[model samples]
Target: MNILLTGASGFVGRELVRELQQRADISLALALRSPGRSSGPTTFVVGELAVDTDWLAALARQQAVIHAAARAHIMKDEVADPLAEYRRVNVEGTLNLARQAAAAGVKRFIFISSIKVNGEATVNGKAFGADDKPAPEDAYGLSKLEAERGLIQLAAETGMEVVIIRPPLVYGPGVKGNFASMIKLVEKGLPLPLGAIHNQRSLVGIDNLVDLIICCIDHPAAANQVFLAGDGEDLSTTELLRGVGKAMGKPARLIPVPAGLLQLGATLLGKKAMAQRLLGSLQVDISKTCQLLDWKPPYTVEEGLRRCFGRSN
Candidate 1:
């Protein structure tokens, strides 16, 4: 089987390609605009998939497409109108690729959506599932929701299978974004006040997420299914920090501070968003994905974090 993976240079995409390349039944093809410094069973494409590009024609020969490319959120709002920018790439660009894939008679389209589509803030201590109605709060989440609708429509019209994976905070080797910042802080031995907070957040290891993607590629049960994926265990901020510290061969030093104070300080320091994400609970229930795919995370959170921290052999 021929499989095409976009965003091959990304943290997850790079690992996913390497994971698939080792299998005997699959031929790997990577679609990327800027080639990275790694290699695998991949042939790079030089154009962006979101534009009026003719690159999809060459990829049409593949049996499956893993659409992993998107305009990720930055520290500060880069877009003049964030919603418009997100829609252009996340929604319109995604639809364009899906339509072309359908036209090419591709058997399946695998979309990697975000857990934020469920809600920006946590709903009590309860976790959101796949069947929950999309209540996206941010512009980024709204764009992903819009793209998902397009994928469903395209699948209905083209008779191609669609697998939607909504995963929470994925972390692993070469990780960037907010997760990287936390690791650096721990490495510096900075004291964190999150030890007092007991909120839970779902996270997925890159290896575990890659394994789930492999399952979706061929599993008939995954067809036309919406799945929520994460590590089976939901972890608190302190636990996560400790795990990172352990993986990096350091001890975590936490100081208990009032959550309200933290939020207020973050707001004053222009890190209000960061404060909310860290001090808040955002758990996701991945039971549906497990039941449907019969899959579980093969690596523990500590093990995954250690591998990413690069302090282990």
Candidate 2:
């Protein structure tokens, strides 16, 4: 199988490149925004993704495409029109690539979406399923939802198989942003006032997500299907901190603070969204993925954390 992978330098794309290269039956090509020295596979400089970006040279002879690039969600966006900016890349650019790939005889296109398309949080222990009605709460989520709809429509019109994988809080080695901050605070032995928060959240390990992406590459059951990706284990904020502590061989110093008081403080500080992420529940149901594709998350949460910290279990 010949494949073209976009965002080859990104966190998820980088891992996908490494895993796909190890397969003897696959020939991989990377579509990068800038020119870079190749590690092994052929690389194509496609420049910035947009509706008008030409992909003819890159899509030549490519059988499948794994698109993982996007503007990404910014917590503190300074752009005047954030939604338009997000749509420019996530929706328009994605549809543009799909259309071009279809014209180039690409058989399959796998899109890496976000769980935010389902909503910001889940209530009453209900997990977000792939078939759920989309309720995007933010600009980034809305853009992804639009992109998914566009891809499905394109697939119907062009006969190209489209697979959408929505993953929540993917974490692994070299992770950045909030996950990295938590690790740093724990490493410094800083006392965190999050011991009392009781909220369930699902996280996907990078290894597990990459494995699922590989499965969707050729699985007949994956054609035109939306799948949710996770580690199949839900963890509370306190439990997650403890797990991270266990993995790092350093017990977390947590202070038992009331969840209500924390929320109040966050509201006062105008950090309600951040607080919800730490205090609210967001779970994904990946049972459909397993049943349809006979797939399982190969790495357990504990094993994944150990790997994240460079420790062997």
CA RMSD, predictions in order: 1.9, 0.7
For 1-313, candidate 1 gives per-residue lDDT tens digits of 9988888777888888788888999998888776564756667664765657565545758899998988875557866999998998899888888878888878999999999899876757888989999999889899999999989988888898999998889999888888988988988998878777677888999989999989999998999999988888888888888888888888788898878888889999989778878988898888899888888889889778877866564
TM for every model, in the order presented, reads: 0.94, 0.99
Across 106-222, the per-residue lDDT of candidate 2 in tens digits comes to 999999999999999999999999999999999999999999999999999999999999999999999998999999999999999999978999999999999999999999999
Superposition error at 204 for model 1 (Å): 0.7
Model 1's C-alpha root-mean-square deviation from the true structure amounts to 1.9
lDDT of each: 0.85, 0.96
lDDT for 121 in candidate 2 is 97
Lowest summed lDDT across 10 adjacent residues in model 2 is found at 37-46
